[model samples]
Target: MGPSRLHLAQGALAALALGAAVLLQGQAPAASASSDNLTADRVENLRLGGDGVAQRRHMWTIFADMVSDEEPDFVHWQGESGVFGAEAAKRPSGIQGFQRPKSIGGDPHLIGAPIIAYNLFNPAAFAHIRAQGLYRKATLDRLQLTGGTGSVPPFPAAAIVIKTAWWPVAPEGLTAMPVWDPELNPPDPTGNPYLGWARVVAVDPTNISQGKTAAVQFVGRSFPGARRVQLEAFHHVAVDAAMAKQLAGDPESNRTAIIALGRPIAVNDQLALVGINVMTHEQQDWVWGAFWWHDRPEVGPFAADRPSTLPGPWRNYLMQAAFDAKTPRASDAGAHICFNPWLEARFPDGGQGGGTVSNCLSCHQRASYPAAPFLPVTRGAPNLREDPALAPDRLRTSFLWSLTLHAQRD
Candidate 1:
């Protein structure tokens, strides 16, 4: 959408300034200081040798900024009320400080535990869409019909889109942390032993009412121990007594769990972030990265080059990044997979076998307005040849699925 409308003039001007700022940094050398310092050239020049050691460091800076930025949390940002519901729509301007998500919604596709996912937009991205009125179906439809050439309307270079996964915590879960070492449980060979187990809630799809707790899985890692000084290890949020009142809207439900909000834990309950997918529009194709929390964050190729300043539980994460769909071609022989287990691991069409082989940029490349099926190919290189989604001149969403999934009808 162009700035042809009088109403969007002011926003368009602001976007220009933001665009210049982003382009300036994007064209420059990778910043030595720790911020969102990923340059487009750095992403384009990435190599997969040594398991992408240098590439992982570049991606970690984005993660560091996302978790440690003094800005309001993604859930509290603008337009979340309409997209994720009121629980996520706490206005940022009025907020006193950085607040965590009020409630986390469950994803049925994910097999075990009460898993939650979030689609977040930074200020620059949200402001651009709001200015263009792209959130409305009518506007999107109009643009689809009349909007000029190009695959998609390019977003500001500073624009960021994030998808994060979280797991709710219970008091019993905290106390039940397993200390078993990997040497003892050789059969359970997916992840580390110190990472701890997550309480799995099994649900029958046909009968939502019928459900029960399943066997524990190697998914979560809990907070601190007996020592008073030991703070929580994960980037977590707690629904305290006051916030609980605001959410429930009932005096009696204040101290009780907000089960209706998809949070089974009580009023003061907490949830820890488990996985995240981050993307930036600084480049034309966009820079993509995925992260999953790990107890032994020190090990693995994904954990390479982590900055010392990454801060707190954020350091306890492993990362993988993909700059191009098929640059450093499949040396690992896993189809150049770059996916978060919590966010995409369960989808049957996620990859050739499943999420294990999925690539973020490849899947997101199919994001079009009329809504194309996001099918992931077995291999990372060579995207769908004759994409039915891109045919018939569909309005591309510039690799943002949120625009297709959550755009409102007015």
Candidate 2:
């Protein structure tokens, strides 16, 4: 959940600013505003059709003094976490604009601690869909079905936490690299929903059971001792060197996963927070309107020798991906649902009890951050994976091509 706490969003969040789409909107009806109201127009006057948007200091501000010193933790984080809810979560006036937009992770300008990059490396096509059989009956219906529930394991946890992360200060005096421009200030350009390139400090999980060492909890209370019982197995290619050039010459998105925890957890870690699962590709039924999606705009910047381009039938273009993509809806029962390591989340007996794994575990389990899956990712950085010219460990292996996606269905 790049913006953090997806399931949240429950009540008064009407109190805005993750830079309310660039400092409280208002302006631009083609352009020019003393106050037509896009949120009072500041983010550098904005301009969509003319092409000048990403304002708020041309985006990637890095940290406008943490939006003027955390302005009361962004005003009690806009009235307690859920970033505004109740009234059935408003925003339907004419599409997009209720409040709470900014926050690409640590709000107000940025200054480290944002974390939302990807590639938790669990390849071999998620170990061949965890040795399927209809994915072992959808992991027994995500460890056992929902709401009125039957199938269980909804997040037990014997250990698998990376907690809070945020580190970005040296792009070597940036000239062109960081970006998260949501747009609205006089700049609608189709109201750029999200286009942040990518940015996560670490975490390369995929040890299914090989276990190389993992015991690194760093909860809240603002990180005190920040305990550290064990170590190793996160490697993340030694903490992201942009994955040695996106895993070079792919080995089916290059293999070697690390860490595998399953045995229930969390009871007194008592910090109503949750995270680190990573797999929410759901908008299905083969293009079910594919949510009218947009911006593929004929892909982009391809050629870098196009990652050598040849491998077993183009290696399914290294297993394609598109989770929710703005509004993409696809159907037939499935289209965008990813997070395949045989879709793990196996916790039936460690801390909380009733195991966990519905993928989205039914509406994000009433989210207080409960296994949060805000997962909107891929807003922009269009290397579009699959083979975005190669890198996310090299692509391919969305479970070794689901039979090349069922051989494109007979």
Candidate 3:
């Protein structure tokens, strides 16, 4: 059957650094979110990634299904895996046992590099996938580019490619047909199984570039505890340096990227959003809250001044992920935690649209910018002169007060 009922907001808590201007927020010192909560330490420890041998066996044995250990309605997890792991489903291990493509690039079936994979319960095929698993692995409707891929360098943090899919299962290619079998589907999204919101995460055996077979973490979500629901989304996803500039207002706005999608959302009631690192650099991006969003799913008119929807603990976690200055530009690198107010949503979207506002520019420019997609140089890079101590993170010292909008003319 569909499983139990749950409600997850379509805008699954999204956050990215705004170049170096101040990602999570343009905060003040005291605004630093309490590291105590927000699963900070849990992320710091490397073991959370799980032992490779054991993990592989588990996925194969279970054949990947949407597994969930009930927490209070406030925190119904779809089942936990490594840092960037997804629920167990056919996504990770389809007909072929886990195998990576010879040529290193991206995946045509999923998002990210297929690092960590778990389960995605599709709805329409209730009779097919109901007995177990999150949702059936299938595609939803709409969109231009159906599939794409890229190479994921071995790094400590997990990387994920996200997209909002639809219609759980159809004839094969993208179609417009869905089925909701209440007797077997009420617990899930009727005929919805595994059609939307997933990550093609890259998992390394040794956490090194030359590691072994890269694994996948296919994850999906439904309102953790509440029934089913959907939200609209308007996102402008960008990365690295360009993202930083958008927040700093460096290019005065030209450096920004934008997009809009509308869809229904489900909220788990307890946890806001849960996934793994989509991209990693010298900086370790911790999940931060207290980001600003004008609304859900559908992003509103963005301007110079806007508040963040991200919460506090979530913000600090992202702010803490760091990078070593000496690391090579192209080689594996981690960034110190950074959250861009420029990216609106604070949670993950379950393959729909219209949840929060976002701008992912630097990611598009992955060709030129090195290190982190789009981060600000410590003020004075090639020519522009500025100071490092005055960095928004350094200045605010906290994630909360940092979110405040300021005027240069002052």
Instruction: Give the candidate number with the greatest lDDT.
Output: 1
Residue by residue across 277-306, what tens digits does model 1's lDDT show?
888875778888988876567876777767
TM-score of 3: 0.18
Q: Global lDDT of each model?
A: 0.53, 0.20, 0.20
Superposed model 2: Cα runs more than 4 Å off: 1-116, 119-138, 141-148, 157-175, 179-242, 245-410
lDDT of 2 by residue, 48-98 (tens): 211111221222121221123313112121110121122321322110111
List candidate 3 stretches off by more than 4 Å.
1-410
lDDT of 3 at 173: 18
- Total backbone collisions for each predicted model: 0, 64, 179
RMSD of 1: 12.4
Cα RMSD of all models vs. native, in order, equals 12.4, 23.1, 24.7
Q: Give the clashing residue pairs of candidate 1, or none.
A: none
TM-score of each: 0.66, 0.19, 0.18
Which tens-of-lDDT digit does each residue in 237-338 have in candidate 3? 112342223222321111111100011111111111222112211113322212222212122211112214323222211111111111112111321112
